[model samples]
Target: MIASYEMKHQVPYYECDATGHQTLAMLFRLLILASEDHSDALGVGTAKIKEYDGGWVIINYAGDVDRLPRENETVTIKTYVEAYNRFFVVRTFEVYDADGKQLVKVKGMFAFMNLTTRKVASIPEPLIVPYQSEESRRLPKVARPQLMANDLAWERLDYRVRFFDIDLNNHVNNAVYFDWLLDPLGGEFLRHHRLVNLKMKYDHEVRAGEKVDSQFIKIEEKNQIITHHQIQCQGKIAAEAEFEWKLV
Candidate 1:
């Protein structure tokens, strides 16, 4: 097993919403910071990755935020290698109370890219060696995303695409998907239950001119929630997603 890397942080004022809990955006920031610390620990920091003519970028992710850290509460984040396949490496992260009960788990899919060419490349030998040397790591083993088996039902909420939603990519950034997925649930769902986990699949690209529809479904029997979101053009699924949320 790879040695666990730990990072300590206090929830910052800007990170919390008006209700004094960490916001979804802030949760992403915490993962990014923890990822950086993990890279730095491995001697494969960003600079070194770039020096080798490649860098890693997130292609996909599944995260479960169990509890929101209150403002000023110090928490610890621990991360480790879970497992990897030829094209992608999977890593896991857990956020915990200072006393160590896990509050969140994040699993990421990463691809090595030749930054100059903006294309996927083989993970460099130096980088792969150390990570692979450790005991094999695998993803959290969450259930597979359910493709719409039939004419599934969904509650729709139409949202306007704004300039703020557009990122440097000149399109709605991938991270923005979480907001669209979560928003239809309203504030109460977000506030009361921790997000146990989620899965997002991007079937089509979302552009600025398009208005998107957010859809939601609750599976009470499984104590799980799933959403089938799409940006329709002439009535076709533009992007499809099935998120799994377990109540804390």
Candidate 2:
């Protein structure tokens, strides 16, 4: 079994939401940071992967959140490579409060992309061996985002992909999609709702200067509110996501 790596962090005001708790975007970034640090520890960091003309790209993220950590609240993050196949890897992250309560649990599917061609590539042994993750021929299927029940109600917003959105590998960072996905809900709904769960998938890359259409619709039920989002660029679906929320 592969060993898990952990780090502690104190929430900062800059990463928090209006409610003082960390925003979902920040939460996602923390997970990325944890994974990067872990990769460095195992000698398979981004710099090393770049040497092979490739970079890791997130394909999907599915998770549950009990609550978000507030400003100045310290939390522990643990992450590890869970499994891998010929072309994909599965990793998980767990966040805990000072009291040892699990605050967030997330699992992500990732694939390696050839930097030169921007196409999916087979996993490199140098990158996967150090992590000691179990090599499997098959992996479990992740939940997919569902179509909006009512398309006419979707609120749409148009955004131009910014230069800053592109990372070192010349693609929009996956974390940035959280902003595009959530912003369509408007400030009023965002401030009043707390995210409890999320399921997001990337179907295509959104390159710089491309115009993207972010659309979503909210479905409120007795127990929870559900929002389905889709991002389109160049006349194709770039991504899709669904989020579960409760009133704050």
Candidate 3:
């Protein structure tokens, strides 16, 4: 059995931004696709989830990017199940350029939620045993993203959840949250700065037609710009993320 799954992907034009490099959000999308493909190989993908009326939901994600692949560049994404518990699983990802230079490394925590209950469910042994993944009694954890100060002056943008933002699980796709979090930064910042690292936490799910408020505050450190973002829906925090960027 393969210990890890890997696939090659060409960075497409639409996935790049004005800077001609893959956007931070698109990197996440690619990682997600790689993860899905890996799960399918392990026989625990969408079809398997349906067998239990459950779906995988990301709880936390943290990653560091040495460089972002440019348009048309072929990159390889490799993924493996690092560990898991009854309710949560940890997965790791590595992205490499065609020359085999590593570009990014990421870790994510996810939980299987019962569709009807909308609550975490124990992963079935059939699903867990196939991958020969390490099992632990405790949930795999990732560092929580820094919270933005409520009193700080924040730039806010409002958006209505669109159909395209919804995924098969019927909630706003996790990748879309990065868009909502960063778009408020505007073109100038996005064009001149490149994301170096990020940590994100999903607090609640946003449904289609719901209005969301994206708020952020930027803080400049010696060589990096750290932006704290919050997305709120229906008076509750839906998601939060911290992004670290460097001048390109």
lDDT of 3 by residue, 108-160 (tens): 99888898998999988887787677887775567778986789998999999
Best by lDDT: 2
Model 2 — TM-score against the truth?
A: 0.93
How are the candidates ranked when ordered by lDDT, highest leading? 2, 3, 1
Each model's total of backbone clashes: 4, 0, 0
* Predictions in order: lDDT: 0.69, 0.89, 0.88
lDDT of 1 by residue, 12-32 (tens): 898887668787667776776
Report the C-alpha displacement of residue 226, candidate 3, in angstroms: 0.8
- C-alpha TM-score for every candidate: 0.75, 0.93, 0.94
Write the residue-wise lDDT of candidate 2 on 133-157 in tens digits.
8888887666778865544677899
Instruction: Give residue 239's error in model 2 in angstroms.
Output: 1.3
Choose 1 or 3, whichever is better by lDDT: 3
